[model samples]
Target: MKTLVVYYSLEGNTKEAAEKIASSIGSDIMELVPVKDIPKKGLMKFIHGGSGATMGKGTELQPYTKDASSYDAIVIGTPVWAGKPCTALNQFLSDLSSTEKVIGAFAFAGGSADKCLSFLREKYPSIKYTVSLADRNSKKLAPENGSKLSAFIEELKSELISN
Candidate 1:
């Protein structure tokens, strides 16, 4: 199956994870870039990012080259902000035109990602698989989280075979 990994990253954690997943599964990857991004560093980042996430806002996105609907499976990655996906990812999901493809999701968070993962599942019922990485900014691709990522990839491979 042709799979696509789509993600948004502010601090590069989500991007790193997406790259790893794409490499492991031999899938194409795409980044979601917002036209007007929040402050990347400083107190304003927390204030703006947290409030935007809590309010479930979707920002305007830059035009992307990939045709997401062409992929058979889609894996979305995002950083957890205020226990929700980032605004860029929210915008991508909102703008997506197809829902019939198989969907999977991954999230990077400072701590627990339960709420973030739950929110994705609740909002997008088509998402069939998910994984969360804790403290991603500090220990991205560390040995501890390797097994979880491997398992996620394996599950996706199995899902593709079944489909």
Candidate 2:
């Protein structure tokens, strides 16, 4: 199956996990870039980025050539903001709606992924698999949280083969 790993990263944590998943699954990758970059430091960053996600605001992304629907399966990754996915990732998911494609998601957060999972499940109920990671434990890609990502990739591969 042709799979794509799409993600948005404010810091490098989400990007690292995405890279590991892409490499493990041997899938193409796409990075979402917001037209206006979010601030990395200070309370304003939290107020703007966190509230944007909380309010379900979408950001303008740079021109991306790959279409998510073209892939047979898709894996989405993002850093959690205010217990939700980042604004840029939310925009990506908002623009992407495909019933024919198999979907999976992974969220990295400084705290927890409960709210992130809740949001994802509510928005994309068809997602077959999902995982959450803490940034402190996800410093390197190969084996984060007892190789959960690798395991997830293997499961996805199995599902693809079975289908």
Candidate 3:
């Protein structure tokens, strides 16, 4: 069994959390980039995410550094912007064809109740969901939370292995 961590990090907060999650369970990582990358400023990127756009900037999709289908489970990570998953994951979601695999959605953000949770649900209706929280500015996560993420990943693996 294999795992993939495919995520978009505007201010690197999500990436930090992703690294923690991946550390708990060995998994290869992929970073999603639009043709034009967003600035590292979290506030401005947050504005762009809520703009109600189908896709953003040149939209040059980075080639799948790793095949999304090869993994037994995939964890999609992004920061909550105006309470929605960044557009990058939403863009990537449409590319995948359902294969009855373990898909999990996790979002990192400092504020907003249920931030990005609804957007992830709207975009990937089929995925099983779990979320994590972190400070947007500091971008540091507690180690124990990675254990929470690890538990989630383990549960998915067990279910997949059982079948």
Candidate 4:
């Protein structure tokens, strides 16, 4: 079955995990980038945060040519910022509505994993399956993250195939 790994990576933490997930499942990858770059640090970051501040309402930002409809399953990932998925991911996800898409998610956070998972679960109630992967820092991937994420993806794949 076709799968898409869509994610928003800040400081590459999320990207590292996303890459592993893609390779494990052979899923196409899509990196979610803001049309406007974010400040790596400083007061500007505190003020605008990320995508929430710059993205236009319903902004598509970096568009992709793939037919999302072709994917039998979709996995999403994001870095947690201040106990939530980065603002950009939140804005971007707001565009999706109920369809028959099979969905899964993994989140990377500096420390607290609960907060990001709570937010995403509430936001995307339609998601069929979900997972959360976090590390203590935003700069690096969690140890053994690739193995853990791949295991979950494999489970999802098995279920899809059985059905």
Q: Best TM-score goes to which candidate?
A: 1
Clashes in model 1: which pairs?
none
lDDT of 3: 0.66
Alpha-carbon error at 95 in model 2, in Å? Answer: 1.4
Per-residue alpha-carbon lDDT of candidate 1 for residues 7-123, written as tens digits (9 for 90 to 100): 999988789889999998889999998888989889998998899999999988899869998888899999899999999988888778885463899998887677899899988
Cα TM-score per model: 0.92, 0.89, 0.74, 0.76
Q: Clashes per prediction?
A: 0, 0, 2, 0
Model 3, 28-127: lDDT tens digits are: 8888887666666657755566663324222346787888877777778877655566677766766767534536767776764254666555555656
Q: Which sections of candidate 1 miss by over 4 Å?
A: 137-143
Q: Highest lDDT: give the candidate number.
A: 1
Tens-digit per-residue lDDT, 66-142, candidate 2: 98888988888888888878889878877877744637888888777768977887777777888877786545642
Ranking of models by lDDT: 1, 2, 4, 3
Q: Give the TM-score of candidate 2.
A: 0.89
Between prediction 1 and prediction 2, the one with superior lDDT is: 1
Q: Any idea what lDDT model 1 has?
A: 0.86
Model 2 residue 133 lDDT score: 78
Per-residue lDDT tens digits for candidate 4, residues 75-97, read: 78877665666765665566545
